[model samples]
Target: MSAEIFDICVIGGGINGCGIARDAVGRGYSVCLAEMNDLASGTSSWSTKLIHGGLRYLEHYEFRLVREALRERELLWANAPHIIRPLRFVLPHHAGLRPAWMLRLGLFLYDHLGGRKLLPPARSLDLHQDPAGKPLKADYVRAFEYSDCWVDDARLVVLNARDAADRGAAIHTRTAVTAARRDGDCWRITLQEKDTGRESEIAARLLVNAGGPWADRVLSLSDQEGGEGEEGHRIRLVQGSHIVVPRLFAHDRCYIFQNTDGRIVFAIPYEGDFTLIGTTDRDYEGDPGDAAITPEETAYLCAAVNDYFRTPVTADQIVWSYAGVRPLYDDGASAAQEATRDYVLRRDGGDGGTPALVNIFGGKLTTYRRLGEAVLDHVEDVLGARGPAWTRRAALPGGDFPVTGFDDLVARLSADHPYLVPTHARRLARLYGTAAWDLLEGGEAALGQHFGADLYAAELRHLVAREWAATGEDVLWRRTKLGLRLSEAEQNAVADAVAELRAALPNRP
Candidate 1:
């Protein structure tokens, strides 16, 4: 085992930790981040994939959270135009449910709550005549349309981690922080790779517990006692599950449906061939890593959307389903849905003599960047080693192109490689942006062997080399959504290909 030292050691590679690592490394901090699993193998990748102010949060009276998330939405969209693009959602007004007046007011606040730039404002819609309403029931005569952005959630996390690595942060994926303890003024931590079962030790001036769903479990690793005795760790494990069905509508717009049960569901166009419906907020017990969608939850989601759409959806038709455990801050909320979406950073051991530990509890994808900024604020106060904050204006990895330049980028990509079809070129540009050229610079001939779908050997090589993608699941699921498109045999081929490439590599992270 190799022994080394660092200024900051972050334990988790989700969006929040990666975001923090990116900010820290850019600010010239010697940093190391370890993830027990693949990056975004938790709640970060399993989001509804919207970068928006939670409209429902308005009912919770969380004004501050909504505003911050709304503001961060634009910043995130601006920072990553390739994977994050503006999406418009249509909320059809049901006669008996929340009155039209309430919906209008909510839309008003949602629009003005955050500064308006880039995205268009919310507007009233005549569902009777509007194209977005074509798929809804006949009785829903009016609707409201608002703007949010769609993110390839898993890719977003990977991009942040990639940028952090680019800035010189040692990122250890599939490595678990087995134990941690305070050694005088530093934190001595033990890490074990999941596959190899090899243990290594390192010391860091600061430790960060960014375990999303397992914050409490992570805290136990350090065996540190806190003042909130009996209260225990503040994380409320809430499992949100989503089901994807065959394309429900042909429109580009998304639908946000309100249920009589005071809950809401989003039916969004997914992956060009399916409709994604989601998210029941039920209090979950047991290991979050084992969280999966239950039959009842699937029925609930299907029924939630069935109340609005003209074509009814059934459970058996689901192409894919995913459930993620939300590590919400338990603020004595009456229900799991009512729990706070905002993040809380509880700092310990930073007063004077002891080393500092920052434990992050509860955050949403929309506000991850700001959450990271806040984490750095705590780090600066404790470590006294500092640099200026600079993530807001930075374009992550290959996202340097203009926000509206997607079509142009696609055109350029196809032109660069004339052999690439329209579908292949567009997928490449969206996933890799200008970075696609790195793999395709040799044109179709240099793209190596085709592994079916839009995936090629060269692209797989790039993921392995730069993105820390090791297993087939890493490439098919997180790094790209090709799992949905590739067949069982093709998936196995991808796994075999990745294994071949990974084994050939001399250095293993």
Candidate 2:
């Protein structure tokens, strides 16, 4: 066991865990975080990739959740403008489903419920004359356009972890927490390296179970019991899946389609060439990692889009697909779609000489910052306050520019690195913001080996050294979406390069 004890030890490196670590460390608390896989390798990466107030959630009467998420949209965007940007969503009215007046009322509430600022307000659209109507069916004459934020979901997780690490938090990827038991005023945590199978132990004043889909399993590993029963708090594993297809529309706007089954699906413009359609919510069993999109889900998504688009979307049109299991606090809602998205925090063993443990259940990406703040409230109650709340005004690493300064940053990057093509400059600016200069320090010559698709050694080195990226998937998929554009052979080359790079590291396992 390490003699040095941390103030808090976070079990998972997903959004919630990383976000907590960032907030805590920034507040002057000593923190350590462990992730069994690469950061954002789980549910954080496999999202619908929007930072929006849940518009459909209004039907469920989750006003507080919606309002909080809506307020977070602009705040989060300002904090990480490089990976998040404003997006307009078009909700076409279906005469067979929700009535037009009801839609208008819903839009009114959506616009007024949250403290929406910077983002444009909702407006009714005339599909007959608008460009957004061209790709949709002629029957859809009226639609409502509202603002939401598009996020690089995986990058959001990584940036939070990166910020936490930069703020003096110890982040360990590919490390798992095998066992934890309360030891007087601290929790003795057993950690195992997934690759080497080496075991080590550390102590923390408090332990946080932000395990996401694996929350229940992690709770079982600890000596402490969850509230009430011996089985602990039950988390409903709801699998939400998404698919990538050829771009469905030329416009930048996204579409939200309402299915007859009381579920909603989104079809958004993605990767400059593909349409991102998704999110089927269904009850799931077995390992969360093993969750994959079923054929029925594919057909359902195809039908959902085909219901509105002038051109039909077939299953064959799918270019890529993914599924993620959302570990929701089992509220006994009876239906997976009806399950609440609000988070539940359970704190135990804080007083009477026992160590503290905080179990986080059920949270969404849009409200991750707020979730972190809430978790800190519990932490302060246990560990005592060290610093005041400060994450709201802080900008994440490489995100110091203005929220609306994306174009100016791109133009500046292009001017600085004239050797880079327009597309390359724009991509770098979009991903790294001000840090693009740091990546391109030595000009074009410093880029080193060109793996493929403008992915060079300089960016790879930066991802490895700064972003905790050890594998090609971490770089190609999470850090950047180049996996969609790269050929298999090119991908293999990138993988080989990453392996060689990892092997050459001074601290290689």
Model 2 lDDT, residue 461, Cα:
86
For this target, which candidate reaches the highest lDDT against the unseen true structure?
Answer: 2
Model 1, position 95, has a per-residue lDDT of: 84
Clashes of each: 0, 0
Q: Which lDDT tens digits does candidate 1 get at residues 257-376? A: 988888899999988899999889999999988999999999899888888888899988998999999999989999888899999888888877689999999999999999999999
Estimate, for each residue in 1-509, the C-alpha lDDT of model 2 and write its tens digit: 37789999999999999999999999999999999999999999999999989998898899999999998999999998998999999999988899889888988998988888799999999999999999999999999999999999988898889889888999999999999988788889999988789999999999999999998888888985564665468799999999999887888999998889889899999989999999999999999999999999999889988899999998888888999999998989989999999998888878886888889999999999999999999889888999999999899888999999999999999999999999999899889889899999999889999888889999988888788888889899989999998899999988888888887774632
Question: Looking at candidate 2, what is the lDDT of residue 361?
Answer: 91
Lowest-sum lDDT 10-residue window in model 1: 223-232
Candidate 2: which pairs clash?
Answer: none
Q: Which stretches of candidate 2 lie over 4 Å from their true place?
A: 230-232
**Candidate 1: which stretches are off by over 4 Å?**
1-3, 226-232
Alpha-carbon deviation at 93 in model 2, angstroms: 0.5
